[model samples]
Target: MSGTDRRYRHGLVLGKFYPPHAGHHHLVRSALARCERLTVLVCAASVESIPLADRVAWMREAHPEAEVVGAVDDHPVDLLDPAVWEAHMAVFRAAVPEAVDAVFTSESYGTELARRFGAAEVGVDPERTTYPVSGTAVRKDPVGSWTFLGPGVRAALTRRVVVLGAESTGTTTLSRALAAHYRTRGGIWSETGWVPEYGRTYSEERLAALRAVDPGADWTQVEFGSEEFPVIARRQDADEERAARDGSPVLFCDTDSFATTIWHERYLGAPSPEVAAVAARTARHLYLLTDHEGVPFEDDGLRDGPHLRPWMTGRFRAELERSGRRFLLVTGSPEERLRTAVAAVDGLLAEGWHFADPLPERR
Candidate 1:
């Protein structure tokens, strides 16, 4: 039948969708193509780490035309038992009470499930030849299946590492070096992502705007408004999100929205709660702070005096401590600092992704 053929009046696509992957999406799209109307039901168990609402949201974003619904199904799977089948159906029916003409799935139990629903069984990619991915594989090792995952899922699962410190303290250098180190491992690591400092871009733009009116104007002539800090923070966070979607499992950031709050204070001579709120939007996994000590401060026209370095470093340390964020102080030679940074990141990756085990199946 053609893709636009409405073979099924009302179709149903149901799955645990613990975390929506490309395979699940392909199944849903196939069902949509065959049916006039489609409903993608996402069932998540109580023990699952990823929230049901989040899965629903991801599905909605992925397939906006389809009606996406979520339900809490804590029942264990046992295709052999009729009693277990009934129990599972009770939860499923509660979420989707409307009549279903076709039930689409890749599971072996699709025949019985469609029989019970009085609907035709529409099998799709049962052998996993098309996408060749599953939620279990993603939960176990996201890096291995990074290419199979969509942008929203990648943004959520990506381990974000931010490198930040006072101006002229090698923040950009360390971030790029870290990304380069990861890329050497090859495979998925070769695609390791790095997000640049959006604040610098904003600074350059501001200086250019100043120079537009006065061609000889220097960086000192550039002025900042309290309202602009939040804009910069939001843009930095957005840039990180874009990189995480297409990059490897781990992503490196030169400076994040969180660091923008400190810069806001430095420029405006006071704290900015608005900028802090913007910073809170990102999930930064680790932070590497480059110590200004023993490092020559280059006046890049945008940098402040050397005396401000100690104060800025102290502020970052104190804020990180108060906020209870995990951070490493990069002191000593450049080589030693890279070693320390690599070790810290390695320790974090060593922990691996933790997914709560689902309820054991029973016969």
Candidate 2:
């Protein structure tokens, strides 16, 4: 078929494309071949890890003839703030073109997205598609599946791994151990460190702004309940792609959204809806929990007071279950925790999990 004749008239594919993989290739190729023109809306947050330019470059390389476009910024602010789902709908309606005929996705949210955008929703079946890969899977085990990623992507995945945890919970120790393990396994390990505790840095300033908006507002409530919790939660997601590129089989997060959930519950007395949603979005496997008693609780700048050993651990377990995420809870001494973590990684590898980086051979 002639290029013009075969192109999609108006079709769109929207995703983080942290590093677009063969599965993305399958969908885009199909869309390009079916529609007169295909517009790929690369999420702005995706740029944090794989730059928007690089993601677009990979897409162009894979489907050279397809018409691809980049969305300039993060999904509307309301989209990230889960309490305002309706507001997010309004933003989606305003931001996305009304003329697009179809929207393609492998996520459950695609249906709602199609309705909001006034487009037909096409589901991409990963198992039946050209490549069954997920960004989550790739971040967990990049080295083992380097063959599945593009050249530039493979290079990006090799530079950073972000380890996160609650205060005094052995995050630093585990991150170091994981780095050592990766090197021992003949892989390079790089640590970009944790997302800064934005709450501590900006809490007073944010509270001041809130008070300015509503002079009669309960400043204390807004401080802990409103601003502090959510800021830290949001920062957690900002680091995902960078950690993926740092190219380790597993990102080896010491504490993740689950820990954040416990923090909100314990400190704020109730979990912020925003933090809960962030937990859901960023929750993934390879979440390693250190034994509360074994890791000496110290009052680091971010971590203070005694570690909530029992309560937090239980909360972590519950949140993981509720979120339907698989996690490895490492108890006992430091040595025991390390042994357990290694076993968990091996188990995941044996299950045939592949990361999102598209192998050159597959391309």
Candidate 3:
């Protein structure tokens, strides 16, 4: 039967969706409109880094109307190889519990896939007329192709604006304000917010666990080592990434691993090479340095004494300068710091800043 004339009872579409984008959305939407029901199989290779379950979750969240399934298949993605295609087809069949009446896809292999499944082929936007972006292109330049991504995938490629400085320098306050501002309309980037500091949260959680086990445990006496910083650094990265997966276009970080590294040195006398390496590898779009001048220092159980704030702040500045990273020094009242941060973000927007791959290190 002809593609247009035949009605599909149950349609199937499968793809990696390495990071799902608008193009995938378009294909799914088109399939849903034509078929009575659609089953999207998010088949990921065993070798891919992104979690298959996470991708499946996004698909379900994105298209609640369709039935989404996640599966791990070690078969080759290349459909041109007969042996490989046969192996993949077997996995595809097993992934779907019931019979599929039609196969929906944008790739040229949809005809062969449908034939193998004993179903009709429904090609949607194979010529890329509707959505002209690919997963590979999105990976290479996510910031450039930001418009094509959904919130979850957008977070995967988000540019970070880290609000870093000494304790009580309005880092948390500024980060929350920045998030609120972005969530409101009429700005360069709206409906976006910031990621809270994971380091402090993790510490608080660990301390609470200790307290739970030992009621008389003193929070002030908590000790740390080089290993702790690396763990904190990794968790900090995880928190930022998880928040960004569904957060705004510009993710304002209350603090980053870079700050964690400084704290490591202050407390442990030396930062672990692992933590330092992680901080150096991940690049941020901009660093807004909050000066301690005229800011009140309130003691949180985790913070060092107010007297050491300036020294810590200086070390942060030194780290930024030594790394030759972009930074903006923000001082004055809370309102002033927010204004400066906003202006910096606005400037970035004006310049059409898109996150690109880090350049090769110089000799």
**Best by TM-score, which number?**
1
Residue 110: error of model 1 in Å? Answer: 1.6
TM-score of candidate 1 on Cα atoms, chains taken together: 0.94
Say which candidate scores most in lDDT.
1
TM-score-sorted candidate list, best first: 1, 3, 2
lDDT of 2 by residue, 1-363 (tens): 854344446888887676676677777777776777777776545326456777777677667776656654543433334445565454444555558888777876778677767888877784644575766656666554465676557535433233344456675676667656755655343332233334444555665677798876543444355556666766655554455544444454444544566777877788778777776764355566554766777753333456456666677667667766666666777777677777776676566543333222110
- Candidate that beats the other on TM-score, 1 or 2, i.e. the better one: 1
| Superposition error at 172 for model 2 (Å) | 2.5
Q: Rate the local accuracy (lDDT) of all candidates.
A: 0.89, 0.60, 0.81
lDDT of 2 at 54: 74
Give per-residue CA lDDT, model 3, range 1-363, as digits (tens).
Answer: 765767789999888887788899999988898889999999876666677887898888899999999888875456567887788777887889788898999987788889988888888888787878987777666555677888676665566899988988889899889888877854335647677888788778878888998888766767776787888888888777777766656888999988888988888887567888878767788899999989888887777678998898899999999989899999988898898889998887556533233212121
Once superposed on the true structure, which residue ranges of model 2 sit more than 4 Å away at CA? Answer: 1-66, 69-167, 187-225, 354-363
Worst-scoring 10-residue span by lDDT in model 2: 354-363
Each candidate structure's TM-score, on Cα atoms with residue i matched to residue i, is 0.94, 0.50, 0.64
| 1 against 3, candidate with superior TM-score | 1
